[model samples]
Target: MIVGEQKPIAEIKEMVAPYKKLLVLGCGTCVKTCFAGGEDETAVLASAIRLVSRKEGRTIEVEELTVERQCENEFIQEAAEAVGRNDSVLSLACGAGVQAIARRFVTKPVLPGVNTTFIGVLEKQGLFTEECSGCGNCELALFGAVCPVTRCAKKLLNGPCGGSQAGKCEVNPDTDCAWQMIIERLKILGQLDNLRAYVPPKNWNTSTSGGPRKLVREDHII
Candidate 1:
């Protein structure tokens, strides 16, 4: 899932200060799970903005709405009426979501209220850890499913870096050495021979063609 964090109140206050009627749009899928911009969080944010506006002797009307997702046009269409009524939008979705809303409503100013963090997983309750870099090419087969590209502090493909000590990363002692996890996992699977073959560096340019990357499913399109 895509992980994100909400922007500070001060920054959000500044962005919506100009708009008398601002819409605080929330995304209920990815951002909801991570507790960033869900329906409840959206309401809290709207109230906060109202309080701040009131304190400043201003009458700022904040309308709150949460869509299933801001990326999909199906869900994007759900917020059309609310969006149309507002002077500006403060999207509390991921960067993609914010941009999607902007693209759909070309004339409206879509301000990002959340900072898109990364594609990550929830390790436990309230603990989200980044597990993928979306490097376009996947090489998990070589490392027993432990991704060195994203987990390694230095992003070393052929690693262990000689700096890691006691199964922990040298650069960030708190982090487990990705290579150590790989080797241990491979040993368990009896696939230690996987490391014997020398692997080439990642061909990032192959799939990531330098500009905005996208996929069009011709099967789904009309």
Candidate 2:
């Protein structure tokens, strides 16, 4: 899932300072699951903004709304009324969400309330770790599902680089060496032979090399 963290309140205050009527929009999908921008968070942020405005002798009206997603028009339409009523929108969603709202409401200012971190999974109740770089081309089958591209500090294809010590990464002892984990996983699956073949340099064209990416599903198109 896409993970993100809420931006500092001080910075949020500065951004919405010019707007007397502000809408705090939340995304109930990715950001919500990450505990960054859910319905509860949206309400809390709106209240905080109002409180700060009152304390500063500024009269700002803040409203809160949460949509299932801000990236798609289907969910975005739900917030149209609230957005139309506000002077500006403070999006508590991911960067993509902020941009999506901006693209739809071209005249209104859409400010990001959270910093998009990365594509990752929830490692634990309170911890989220990055696990993928979205390199376009997937090579997980070759490494026992452990991606060395993002996990390795050096991004080595055939690695254990001299720095792997006691199953820990040399650059950061706190981190488990990607190669070590890969080898251990392969050994368990009885697929250690997968690594014997040489892996050539990764193709850059499939990833960030060309700029923004898009996917079209011809079957889904009506």
Candidate 3:
């Protein structure tokens, strides 16, 4: 899942400082699951903004609302319609959500209220460790499902670098060596020989390139 966190209260206050009417928007999908831009978080942010505005003697009208999602254009359109009547929107979703809201409603300024963290899974309760860098390349089949691009201190395509010590990464003693984990996993899966296969240099152009990346699903278009 995509993980995110709310921005600092002071930064959020500055973003919507010029707007008199502010709509704090939340996402009920990934952001909700991550507990960053959920309904409760939205309420808290709205209250904080309201308090700050009151203290400043600013006539700011802040309201909170959540949509099923902010990534999709349909849902973003709904949110835009619901909050467009206001002066501006303070999006508590991820960066994508904030952009979506801004793109849909060109008139109102859609300010980001959260910081997009990473593409990861819950490692344990309350711990969301990054797993994927979204490098636009899939190397899981060769590495026994471990992604060295994100897990390794250095984005090494081959085996363990010489920097690893005592199964710990050289970059940080607290973190485990990503290559060690990969080797162990490959040994268990009986795919240790696959490690001998050389991986070509990644084509960064296919990933980030020069501008924003996009994927179009014709079947989904209606």
Candidate 4:
């Protein structure tokens, strides 16, 4: 899932200070799981803004709403009436969600309330760790499902660089060496010979170097 963190309240205050009628829009999917911009978060933020405005002797009407998702048009459209009634929208979703809302409501100012972090998974309660870089091409089958591209500090294809020590990464002692983990996993799976064949240089063109990507499925298209 896409992981993100909520922006500072101070910064958020400054952004919405100019607007009298503000809408705090939340996403109930990814951001909800991370506790960044879910329904509860949206309400708390709205109340905070109102309290701040009251303390400042100013009146700011804040409304809270949470959609199933902000990235998809169908979910975003559900908030159309609420959005149209607000002076501006404070999006507490991922960067993609914020941009999607902005694109749909071209005339309204869409302010981001969260900083999109990375593609990752929940390691434990309240702890999310990045696991993928979305390089377009997936090479997990070659490395026993451990992605060296994301785990390796050097992004080495055939690694366990010379600096690795005690099964820990050279870049950060706290991090496990990607190659070490890969080798162990391969050994356990009886696929150690897979590393014997040298991997050629990766074709980065398939990645972001090609710019914004799109998937087209003729069979799925209606």
lDDT scores of the candidates, listed in order: 0.93, 0.94, 0.87, 0.94
Decoy 3 TM-score against native: 0.93
**Deviation of model 4 at 141, angstroms:** 0.5
Worst 10 residues of 3 by lDDT: 202-211
The root-mean-square deviation over C-alpha atoms between each candidate and the true structure, in angstroms, is 1.2, 1.2, 1.6, 1.3
**Could you estimate the TM-score for every candidate?**
0.96, 0.96, 0.93, 0.95
Residue lDDT tens for model 1, 122-168: 99999998999888888898899999989999888888798989999
- Give the clashing pairs for model 3: none
lDDT of 4 at 23: 95
lDDT of 4 by residue, 55-159 (tens): 988889999999999999999999999999998999999999999999999999999999999899999999998789999899999999999999999999988
Candidate 2 lDDT over residue span 55-152, tens digit each: 99999999999999999999999999999999899998899999999999999999999999999999999889889999999999999999999999
In candidate 4, stretches whose alpha carbon ends up further than 4 angstroms from where it belongs are none
lDDT of 3 by residue, 43-148 (tens): 8889999998999888898888998899888777777556867999989888888888888888888898889999999888888888998877677888889899
